[model samples]
Target chain A: MTTEFATRHLRRIRLVLWGVVTAVLLATGGALMMRSYLLPPTSEGISVEVATIGETDIRSEFTLMDHTGRAVTEADFTGRWQLVFFGFTHCPDICPTTLAYMASVLDLLGPDAERVVPLFITVDPARDTVPVMAEYVAAFHPRLVGLTGTEAQVAEAARNFRIWYERMDDENAPDGHMMAHAGHMYLMRPDGRFDDVFQEQDQSPQKMAGQVLARIQESQDVK
Target chain B: MRVLIVAALAVMLPLAAHAEVVVTDPWARASILASRPGAAYVTAESDEDDRLIGASTPIADRVMIHAIETDANGIGRMVHRKTLDLPAGEAVDFAPGGMHLMLMGLSEKLVEGTTFPLTLHFEAAGEVTVNVPVLGVAASRLDEGSK
Candidate 1:
């Protein structure tokens, strides 16, 4: 009689323990579902201090040639994150090296990376044809977009971004003529405002990406 | 095959010259990019004050000493050199934004937090072994101020 009673008591305890576990799990799942429905994925737990661009009195416009050499305006960047760099195809060293770093940073950014677009706007539009850009950017990543333009359009774009570029004549040239240009990567907001500028000499992709990652604290914390 | 042959040549050339080539920063501790390709500062004191005859790295498929060239427009470019010369104990700095070794066709992307092996050959230092700590992304000389 005692053994039978003891077995019945153990069954009751097990049933109560399972009920508590189920209740806890259900509450947690409901809370998560409610949170997801209430907030945008990127709208919570992230804070950033914007570094204001100094040109308070002026708004700038640019027209550059995309990889297709089709004219692209500032509006082309709408509704997406633009991580733009000013460089040339012939830059053989700094330009590619820096862009490759940016690519690595993007890779590290993981899921939300889809929101950022890596754009390479060349200062040497005269020499960097669309085909040249296509070939060059292919080495970096599938998403890297290269931009060039006619000399006039290229100059206008450079002025807007304050990019400095010039062609140097090498007498015993590797390819006869080459362009040397500054290395600066800019981060454009979804609305195309100049959100941040990363100077080649100032920041690495990791540091810049860190800034980007900081904008998504909760997502980052999940890791 | 060619990379090994060149690396071996880079090692043998210095010994053949009958001069001791010492690479001071074997670990390339003072790396610009802060780390990677193992930044090494090598000094080749020579009997005849010879040029930096050649260079090689066993860990790297193609290692070339490189320098950045910035033009008036302030855009940067890269130029590869065949050799750098050392005149009797003078040191050559293979640093970033200046003269650096370009490690091409790496067998693998080095582990992020770990540094791997590299060997630098000089006209005098026949073979100097080193392990370069992989570092965060590289920022250029111009960026040195920011760093």
Candidate 2:
């Protein structure tokens, strides 16, 4: 009788231990999943996830004046891949750096670059006139096209692309004001659909060119 | 002998203060246009805690210390800083995306492959002048061959 009682006690303890262990494991796994979901996307972690593409409703519809003072729209850039960047020429550091990167990416694309149209849309339309943009884009790549428009047109374009920009007055600034704007580069498909968005931290020209070429090839294969 | 010792102390005092801080890798991005501001970067190391009070260059009318702060969405805003603190035994880097010297009202466009003198003023180190090399507009760091 005592032997049977001890065996039953041992079995009860073993069952309780197993339940505790399983509960601990489940809690730990749940905590890890929650942490990942709550954490903000880091530069290194988020750029690799191609699945996140198109999750945001980004469009390429805009009516603006080209650097040559020609009126144009999204339809004007149809049948060609567009790399769109929104910035002001007055910006000294980030805008120029990103434009230089875009120029390098184009150089890396070489002949295939002809299929791509790199657009620089100004956020500060008040200061970035057609001639200013013409001179600014000329300093970067020969093929780079600069675009500027009226405040309402620029605002509509920025809203379509989900770009945020604000002008802050500064006494020391050249124009007595400075603009803060998003720095992401948008790669639009030939069909005017958003293909990918390059973050400011992605400064690799070679990698960008490779990705662009791969996408182009993929689209061609589909056709 | 006493007169010689006094003269030696006077010369050595300034030298000692200057030797406490070392500035290197001074460089600036070539300005794409004369109407726009230019940016310059340098690495500074100090033996004792010091503050970078001001900076100046003959090429620009004003040299303002600025820092680029990025929000969670990766939007960058340029903030003007009156001074920068350099802690003891720590190297403060003024790089492309972080802290930089904003050269405002430039006399002329900063052409590539050129050099200019940048004078930095420190609370303890006094005024130190570094010959800054102008790199390409998109250059993030000094090239391997160029100093």
Best by TM-score: 2
Most accurate candidate by lDDT = 2
Could you report the DockQ of all the candidates, in the order they appear?
A: 0.07, 0.24
**Each candidate's root-mean-square deviation in Å?**
23.5, 13.2
Across A1-223, the per-residue lDDT of candidate 1 in tens digits comes to 9999999999999999999999999999998865544322322111111112243322235777778667788787677777877765434345655776777778878887888888887665655779878776776777888888876887777666655444433322222223333355677666666666665446666777788767545334755
DockQ of 2: 0.24
Model 2 misplaced stretches (Cα beyond 4 Å): A1-55, A172-182, B1-19, B72-75, B144-147
Q: Residue A37: error of model 2 in Å?
A: 40
For each candidate, give the TM-score of chain B. Answer: 0.57, 0.81
State in Å the error of residue A68, model 2: 1.1
